[model samples]
Target: MNTQPATRPAFQDRHILVTGAASGIGAAVARQLLAQGARVSAVDLDETGLQRLHAQAPHRAASSRLEDASGHLWTARLDVRDSAQVEQVVAKAQAALGPLDGLASVAGILEMGEVVDLDDAQWQHCFDVNATGVFHVCRAVARRLRERRAGAIVTVSSNAAATPRAGMAAYAASKAAVTQFSRCLGLELAPYGIRVNIVSPGSTDTAMQQAMWAQGSSRAAVIQGDPSRWRLGIPLDKIATPEEIAAAVLFLLSDQASHITLHDLRVDGGATLDQG
Candidate 1:
């Protein structure tokens, strides 16, 4: 009788880097990757949140005894806004965790206001983190992945990128930028056997979403369309969990999606009415 343990995880022995790992979608992706036996290099600007994530997935630790084992999990404090900092961190993470097999850029921010009322800083900041931040990480990782001749990359965009939303002009535009950028990058990396894709989630049950909710009516408002705001409700009639989004991301990163590339998978519960 063969009693050798079967590898239950698809990501076992693979190295993946996740941005925005402190909270929301990034944190969820990190947790799922760790659970799936991936060597994860979790990066985010929030030091405390990274610590909590590291502690929660102790079993995923590279070494049960060593405090800083890079075998299973590693965490780094990173601000994606700075290109140099992003480059340095990616290098350090790749060095510590091993060559990267996958990269998930989940770091983003939200600032809402009427276009007329929105300040210059707000608009720039939105693009800075949402679009430029993605550019920074993707550029850094793509170089190494290209050299290795293989890898998968998933960028977490938003449904708003496809559909218009009131008071979300900046956020919507930034997401649009990432969506197009990912597709173009996919084209560029195709010859190298590297795949790039996008996952656009809508109204997920994350701190970022909850923060946008009103005291009592917000949840219902999100479920039931608000014609006044030119917003349609989710057809599924519920918010998504971060894990749900993470699942889609993992699928794209895994071999199950080997033939898929430059695809934009929307996880919006038909919220956009499938427009365009």
Candidate 2:
């Protein structure tokens, strides 16, 4: 006789942390989380971007009048590559915003070049942000979540992690490392009632993707397979908006995915030819 609504906002009152919250997918994720009534701690190295994001949240105007006053949103400047800083910022966020209910690790950098052409700095920078940075955030947050025995973590990787792409050696390799690391972390955290998952996106319509386009026609070229580079065209015939990827990230972090962990959900529009 209890026929309640089958669905409702899944993130109400939850405190979630999102990295790379300045622009692209990270910004989109923060915005969506705020709209869903979640308390969001938006973290990024770009303090300006973080400020803009905080100002743009839907409840910003009403927050000043609310008595609880802690506001559902906060911003922090964090460089995930530094383990000490990661730990410090995460701890600070918990202190200010309360215990974290979820984490979305979207901070990453893309360095393009053939392996032979890549220098030590370029290679290390790629792993530093894309792989090692993820490790720092995950490790810091996982310890606390493990003790609490609850929470979810989602890492945004790339389709290139699975499909080989010319001129993307370092980026691909680093993503691959995070992909496996997330799976292993998931396995370890499963017993503690925590979930860890990966979202692999392809050719999303963000500034980072636009920068890769050298010519006006580059967008079309991306839609049409480039045999010379061994890249396949998107079967969906369109680049995903940042919000599309954010939706998947939110789902994995919600109770709806309670039974899901160690899963890599591809948001790549079949760009990898369904490669597992």
Candidate 3:
């Protein structure tokens, strides 16, 4: 409800591809991009959430909308685990919205369990979505950006990737892979004038965080530490909204961070004490 539009609409006519755009951090990024005048190719595994996002059109002029769109918004049902599907989607999105100005790789999953208790399928699923999925999309888009010789990318990771979490081994490990991968990618793409950065967020108020509550964790416990599980609470005494995380992401993608690359920005409200 506090989704404030930016005072300056700086990205007019720019194209951006947002994964996990159906909800949470991804959804927040998509809305703000539209508000800043970017054309967004919003893809997610959830078709319904995409439809709902398509209905919110105040960010842009109504006349800019297509028959199935709400101005500067294009929706696609994407499962990033499929490399082939990722390639096709990126191609079609560019054809529809023009060359991509940037990308926000926010599609990811969280599966918590101790290392020894983690099943093969569970471990693989986490890496598939959180790590390999990022690889697929980034490769698809980077190939284009390399030739065009410009653009930026921001991959969403988790703060747990920097700090240890007793029951989040799978999720944390996958996000760690994402963090390092983005750094390596930034290095390789630097000469081409493309920027790649990572945004690692702590506890945030979203359906994903609510699901942890459904599993019996209390909000107070999340904000006040959980020693038994080796989890640190937010020092700020509150959970972040997806929009806050999105702001960090957009900054890195914007010209404001033009000189920054291969950096991992933590938006954890001091939860990890600035851990790497």
Candidate 4:
């Protein structure tokens, strides 16, 4: 049994790049890492949200705040799906923050509609953002980690990947792909001492959740009727909060879980169990 101080900072000098850092789970993870004295680089397409994140830590604000615990964090306004942009940003981040120590892939989208009614463009867009976006960031960061012989990666997946829902076909499938990709990455990267893991969250009470609630309820009679049993409803009896999901990511990235890799850690408040 290994015992250490309960309140020690396990990631004091680690550099972490978090996508979707503008809101929801990504934002929470960034904040948690900062509080633990880790160097953190955050990116999102929402420049306004990035500004707000910086504003929250003005005392520690600097151009590369993500790399410098005492200075401002780095915020990039780039879409994860853009491979060129992702490569450029990763290089810049490593140059500014030092080598890439970790990556948290949290940028994704969920579009709910019957698959037959969904357009090809919509399906492509979701996969491009969710699945391909992950590929871009992971490939870029893992390359550096492999060269250095150390690093960790945690991707945000979804419970929908395991339990199919009526209106979440595209979203579920995208996450399923992400899960498989992460597993493959784990095996391929193990030789270089890199660990890859996935965190699959159920409906969390983020802005995304609110949007989903509205979408399903817009047709209350059609969606909530006895025939459907409101099967698509969040299975936890209530939605989780973003912080809950972030905690799981923090654990997977920390030294406490150094031996774990290539697995899906679900933080859905027993939502999947209820459905099962």
lDDT score at residue 114, model 3, on the 0-100 scale? 82
For candidate 1, give the lDDT of residue 121: 99
Which sections of candidate 1 miss by over 4 Å?
A: 1-8, 60-67, 214-217
CA lDDT of 56 in candidate 3? 73
- How many backbone clashes are present in model 3? 0
Question: Over the stretch 1-276, how does candidate 3's per-residue lDDT look in tens digits?
Answer: 779875767778889999999899999999999888899999999988887778774544444332234468888889999999999999989877889889999999989778899999999999999999999999999999999999999999989898988888999999999999999999999999999999999999999899988888978989999888777888899999999999999999998999999999999899999977
Candidate 1: tens digits of C-alpha lDDT, residues 1-276: 999998678998899989999898999999999888899989998888888788788465444322255458888888899999999998988778789998999999998888999999999999999999999999999999999999999999999998998888999999999999999999999999999999999999887888788534487789898998888999998889999999999999999999999999999889998774
For residues 1-276, could you state the per-residue lDDT of candidate 2 as single tens digits? 978876667798899999999999999999999888898888999877877776677766444221122478877889999999999999888887889988999999989888899999999999999999999999999999999999999999998889888999999999999999999999999999999999999999888888888534377898887987778898999989999999999999988898999999999889998786
Task: Give each model a TM-score.
Answer: 0.94, 0.93, 0.93, 0.89
Q: Per model, state how many residue pairs clash.
A: 1, 0, 0, 7
Give per-residue CA lDDT, model 4, range 1-276, as digits (tens): 868657767778789999999999999988888888777788899888877787775346445333233353677787898999999988887776778799999998888788888889889989999899999999999988999999899999997888877777889899999999999999999988889999999767788877866765532432222335334543345567789899999999988889999979987766566442
- Model 4, CA-based lDDT: 0.82
Give per-residue lDDT, candidate 1, residue 232.
Answer: 90
Window of ten residues with lowest summed lDDT in model 3: 60-69
- What value does the lDDT take at residue 98 in candidate 2? 89
RMSD to the hidden true structure, all candidates: 2.6, 3.0, 4.2, 4.0
What is the TM-score of candidate 4? 0.89
lDDT of each: 0.90, 0.89, 0.90, 0.82
Local lDDT at 244 for model 2:
99
By TM-score, who's the top model here?
A: 1
